[model samples]
Target chain A: MTGGTAARGPLDGLVERVRRDPGAIGALFPAVGRTVGRGPGPSGDPDGILGPTVQDEARAALVSALAAALGDGAPDRLAEEVEALYRFGDAEEKRAVLRSLPVLPDGDAASRLTAGLLADALRGNDPRLIAAALGTPAAAALDDHAWRHGVLKCLFSDVPLDAVHGLGDRADAELGRMAAGYAAEREAAGRSVPDDARRLLSLTHGETEA
Target chain B: MRIFDPHVHMTSRTTDDYRRMYDAGVRALVEPAFWLGQPRTNPGSFHDYFDGLIGWERFRASRFGIRHHCAIALNPKEANDPRCAEVLRTLPRYLAKDGVVAVGEVGFDAMTADEEKAFAHQLSLAAEHGLPVLVHTPHRDKAAGTRRTLELVAASGIPPERVLVDHLNETTVDMVDDSGCTLGFSIYPDTKMEPERMVRILQRRGLDRVVVNSAADWGHSDPLATARTGEAMLRSGFTRDDVDRVLWRNPVEFFARSGRLLLQELAPYSGGAFAGNSILRAQHAEPDA
Candidate 1:
């Protein structure tokens, strides 16, 4: 099971296991963090593993089990539960909840109900929460103003721009202006500007002033 | 320069913060449970948080060679909510857990009757659990809150020495010192008590029952505030032993009442997973073309 090629299968098995024992789903969700180890596995053998951690996969499986348990009849309640889990959860649990948002069974209704959470996360200084909030379908819930600030927060927290979902499609002239202003402030403060600032500035496609 | 931060929320912090803390000579710390920025509506929610404090958080800190211990309580703000009342019943189980050095952060948030009730109740819980108590004074109306807090401690029949009244400023310091309880000052970068202010207080009051900490949490705070205070003490002509006494021994003495401090040197954490969770992100090298 420690072999890299078997990584995807175990994750699938976990989902099926939870689905089969719906009675045990409640116990299993929280246990996912403990049961499936988050260590390096052979899955990303060519160079290295670049995607979600094993714990991430486990959390997603648990959320899927939850969605399956509800069986599309209670999308509103599912959204409510997920939001409560996020709000009351620790940073790790909150991050997991945010990561699983786009995959919620009824995508639109669940997204609408929990959209406010993204903004709350954006306002915090935690890089993990900020990065998770900008991951799309979650990012889609934010309007232009909130989205730009979320990207700015990523830069401020040193969260890589690549963590952001759909950065290419969403980066606009105002975002470029904000990035440029941030760059200027960094320069004035005698701090080195981050590479993401340069990337966001370029995304403006000359719409922003020099 | 070994330090014991008596009140930092390591659960909200990152691994980089831990590495930095270790570098700054922070060898041990206590994380008292407090409000998580948002309100908790259910009692069951507190269980998971408490579990994390005793379980995963302790493991995470061990990985960085910092001894992590926690205090379990229904924080003062949460006491006002009836939904959280049930947590009081479940706290004893957590209080009994190893690595739980104290029963804390249990004091006035709004100075409401509900707050007072929980404060008084947890005081007895601390006595019952044979653990030291960490008390949080209300941020607003702190002097009065400190007065009432001392009053409640006096009423609870717990020894004054075993109770730590935290977040004290200039106005409330003399009173807490007079109360025979341990004085806990949370030094911050901007607000609350500054490191210089902390130095003056130590110089005047002497470090008999004083324990200084960073008390860094979710708000705008610095985890190195405790170390910074130690530096300020040295700059003010205090000796090295004085810094160690206040920064390390003071906290150890206060929480040592629990008989549960994990001060023993831990084997360096080699990225081992705790309960299957590594608390680190996935990383795989790129394939050579």
Candidate 2:
């Protein structure tokens, strides 16, 4: 949940299920194990179109997998619980979760936590998620995220021409056109965007796409 | 969590500025004495401005448990005022005083000869005190000016690790990195680097020796700029380690190099003795959480 990569092993997958799913959510130290075959089930859509029960089922699956892995022998169960909540529980629970992650550091743990948080940060301009990711991710994970595709290509890659990735080309030559439209809309309402933004000089305009 | 902004100015901000920053996660900010939007008059105004950075503003931040730190300097923008420049001779004395961290936000604003001259003097002071220098570059013709600033830093013989090239834009980061100094990018709202753009740039440059700042002063800036950059980096699919390097370890290392205060388990503090103090009473308090 804190900004760091958290490797969710098959064992961890089971524990996540036990914690959240009433089916497994309330298990009293249930014995679980990883078959080592399947990857994580779908995270399920974040939009909440999935009903509450379905969400709980998915959570239970995650909890079950988690319990099977670590076996609850580890101390600091509260911290682990908080980290899970911070990562998967809800938006508001992150801050409380982050305050605890800094105290515990294990191998590949921070990075695993970081990957999920970084994904969250990349999704929006949220501060809490940013702080957690900033505080927790493993060094290598941080390096990977910091120097991502387009940027990585421009700064470190041997070929500057092929650095672009992720950003889709929904519309080519659309920036200038859309910028003009935006400018026109603003003028109609007697408003203004900064000159650079109005002129399509925004950094987002890049090589292509609106 | 407690935060010390390490850079900001409140003279040009409104009450809303304080409120929003407080809410957005800024617990403390360091205001380096610098040039205002325009020129200034007698020492009294300058005194008040410095006062705000260390006095009024300090109180304001502490109200939110944000400890305020001040870096007194003759902003490069005002270096042209020979009468004001005369004050430079006295700045070092203040630089040696309490709450002063690495004679800065002093650097080339217009990249004017006067700015260069002032920068040299400040650098000398930083070296003299074993303090790190926080260098602010100009906003226009930035790449050239950043290069120039680096050239002069080497010319002045200031150690690269002891300098933080601030206000960096995408065009200028290379110059900053090449200088072997730490980079400080300001994610100003609507004015400077946008959050998304910052993520893009970070992706290109590693977080090993760089930091992100809001530089939110009189303009429309977000005090939570660093955090915003963190978020954008994640959306860009970066992992957690990347965000931590840039926001936490990097800045912590920079401040340690600044030869300022040492902090451990520090959190935000919004109250205490941030008012008119006995000059003799000035003492570094351990950072609190």
Candidate 3:
């Protein structure tokens, strides 16, 4: 204990990583990082310690997966892995796996995985996961069926602004920007923009009107 | 490691408080002009706040070798007071001066007609002077206020990319990212967003254009919250590169766009704390050198 306490450097991850093989964090996964008054969460597990460690692993795993997927001949083998990742892995594992899809060249496996993750997170009722899912900004990089679904799902999210952008609190700002674009497009296309939304958008053009 | 708190309001604090923060890992900070504890009596207090944000506070922070920068502006809350208009009038002079990175902490508050009026007017003025905006988010019912803030931004048509929305949280992240402007999260003790949560947000969205700030000002806040968040990011599997990117590089790149003075180009303040050195002045024709 004394040695571990005195020990420091980039290897701090390894110490926590050793704790991961036990499936302790994975077992208590969904409850990690939740607050009491916010709402329901994965019941009574105090995941503070495990939460950070698990997230770190998830990120490292994603980074690894992305690097791997970006490599050549990744298709034939990677295809099988993507399919299985969704069916088996839980949220953190699944998310890390999905994040890998971003750098993977658009193809059969990438398409299916992207669509699935986006649809699940954005369309589902889970706000926390959606917030977590968006940590991967691949939505900006995509244009395929999966990307389209993800973007649309953000618009429909229960906590639309809260869950979607998840970065720099620019979601509402982007929602306004996107809504305006849609309105302009509607105008050129000779369609009417939704009345209430347009009114709100008009008022929110830049900064909140008092 | 030594950490620099680039944004704070030490004017609301005492010198002893400064010593405490210094020991607590804050080596520097940026104190932007804000609405005083009570309403500003007049332009003089605003001037004093501006001066302190840039001068006395800078000197005070320097006593600890904690570099300080200032963002001069008429805070939104005080804008409704007709008596406070002169402060906004002084923007032109400060916008071009040193340590003034952006016309900031300037977006919206209250969602009041007067608030919006001041928001739009200041925004326009910032654009006219070609200064970047250090935006402020409303404290109450934030998501709604955040939406309204974005709406005005869209209407203004200032390149959304140049705006830095502050005090972001889970509720407002989606809105900020979608807006395509840079985002700043003030990781304070109780209010604003927390560091652990900020790391999660950072994890979901790779740090391309996001920044984490202490937003530590003259209230109950921390000067090294950014560094703490940085530490959290590291624990969360982000590399040193990622931590530095969110904590320093991204913000440095954004604030550098201010066109006032590149923070990187400024000469390093080399003397010891409280040394007799005055602030950097112009080197004239064959001086004592």
- Expressed as tens digits, the lDDT of each residue in A39-108 for candidate 1 is 4322342211123445655676678887787778878767766776676677766666777776786566
Candidate 2: residue A14 Cα off by (Å): 90
- lDDT per residue for candidate 3 within A1-210, as digits (tens), equals 111111232224433442443223233323322310111222221221111133434433433443353355566445555545544555554544444455556676666666555544443334344544554555553333333234333333332432333323333454455456545534533345555345437445654533
What are the runs in model 3 whose C-alpha is more than 4 Å off? A1-210, B1-6, B14-28, B262-289
True lDDT of residue A29, candidate 2:
24
Q: Interface root-mean-square deviation for each candidate?
A: 12.4, 18.4, 18.1
Model 2: residue A144 alpha-carbon error in angstroms: 47
Candidate number achieving the greatest DockQ relative to the actual structure: 1
Q: Model 1 residue A88 lDDT?
A: 60
lDDT of 1 at A112: 77
Q: Sort by TM-score, best first: what order?
A: 1, 2, 3
| TM-scores of all predicted structures | 0.59, 0.53, 0.52
Query: Higher lDDT: candidate 1 or 2?
Result: 1
Predicted candidate 3, C-alpha RMSD: 22.7
RMSD of each: 13.6, 22.5, 22.7
